[model samples]
Target: MDLELFLQQLANAISLGSLYALLAIGYTMVYGILRLINFAHGDIFMFGTYMAFYMMTSFLLPWGAAFFIAIILTIAFGVLVEKAAYKPLRNSPRMSIMISAIGASFLIENLAIVVFGGRPKSLPVPDLFNRIIHIGNVSVVSITFITPIITMVALAVLMFIVNKTKTGMAMRAVSKDYEAARLMGIDVNFIITFTFAIGSALAAIGGIMWGLKYPSLLPLMGVMPGLKCFIAAVIGGIGDIRGAVIGGFILGLIEIMLIAVFPELTGYRDAFAFVLLIVILLVKPTGIMGKNIAEKV
Candidate 1:
């Protein structure tokens, strides 16, 4: 590919990667603490998009305020999901929790269809995000450039919260050993809830970005991206935060570059993530950053 084409695709990859990174972080965080894959997470992402859409259209709010409200509401919804769907099953078999997660995902999607309607809604683009910037032979939107910076800042904040805060310590302890953490007087339930809140908040950020980039929202919109982000989490090391970011970038770059170089493969673009997932699983089940642990059983 020519330098200009490469640059343009690079910009696209970076923006797309930012969204995946945000979503993947949520997946990894929840898995780290609960050892359960929250299948409903993608639905939370879908809700974020719809929340932002209604806030802008129905509430007549500005993009900034609407986006903020969407994130807050999305966080609350996530926490509520955990409390209602997963909490009661905490002491049950692991399969029960997983099944509940799947059931909750479907429930959210169906509810979204009923409430948000079956038709797709157009996402309102703020004037600022629509501006284009030119660099040499490459031109891209302002949001394209801004997204990576936002992702980096968010990552820094997440790292600080995970590494430096007292809650972070509790989270680490719980992830390491829930029973042990409880024995040490850590509020395991509160930590788990907090993790869900943070993860759902990240999903909201990603959903907002996804709506902006795609400009179309539907109840099923989160399904594909949600699965892709899960694949990214697995590829990067399922429970490792930093690894998820790396995996997101890898997935984004590969997808963009494949479509750019071979237009024919555009039809199969989504399959590439699954193909990558399979390869990663076959070659290194633990992922790049995940360490294999020996079970006592």
Candidate 2:
């Protein structure tokens, strides 16, 4: 194995992994607090790209402005989805909630297909994201490098909020014991909506970046990333934010390296992630950073 080739592959993995981590943050956050998987989370991401497309082409908005619109709409949609599909089920069983999430995911995907059409659409490439910089012997695109930096910085800011701010405290409170927080006069709805908003925004950012990198937009595009990110979240210890990031990078690295080294196994790239996930489950069922909750009997 060429060590230099392996390192280059590793770099590629980090770029892809960062994107997965960004998306997994949303997934793990919702699950951490509510144990509710927002299946529509992926579609909210899909809508984000559409919002950007419309703003840029129809409204003649600048790329930055269009991206901003996409983020706003995605957040709003996420909040609304929680209100419509989840709030009422706050008292429901975990299985029912998971089903609702699946239903919501399907709803958004079908609606997107109807509105956006079944054909794939090209995403607009702004001049600002077109730069390419060389690192050593490796050539990296501006979007690829900038994307991970932006994701990490945003995560740092989020960590500060979760660990230091009032809202973050409220979030922790909700996650720990929703009823107690509600009794303490925490606005459950607002907190939940806020959580969804942030999660959706992350999904949107990931979606936009994925579009820019792949340069293709389709309603079903979020499926693969969504699944991979979910696995990453689980592998990183499902509810741990930092774990999600670590898991994402690990997953990305593994996938990229596996394909690079064993070019013949490219078809099994996705299978490798699942196999790894299963192995992790067998060894550390809680995941790399997953916490242990001691139930009070």
User: Which candidate's lDDT is highest?
Assistant: 1
Tens-digit lDDT track of model 1 for 157-218: 98899999999999999989888999999999999999999999999988988888899899
Report the lDDT tens digits of candidate 2 across residue range 7-95. 67776788899988998899999988887777787788888888888888889998999999889988888888999899988888888
Q: Against the correct fold, how does model 2 do in TM-score?
A: 0.96
Per-residue lDDT value at 52 in model 1? 93
Quote the lDDT for 86 in model 2: 93
Model 1: worst 10 consecutive residues (lDDT sum): 288-297
Q: Give stretches of model 2 more than 4 Å off.
A: 1-4, 294-297
Candidate 1 local Cα displacement, residue 218, angstroms: 0.3
**Candidate 1, overall lDDT?**
0.92
RMSD of each: 1.0, 1.6
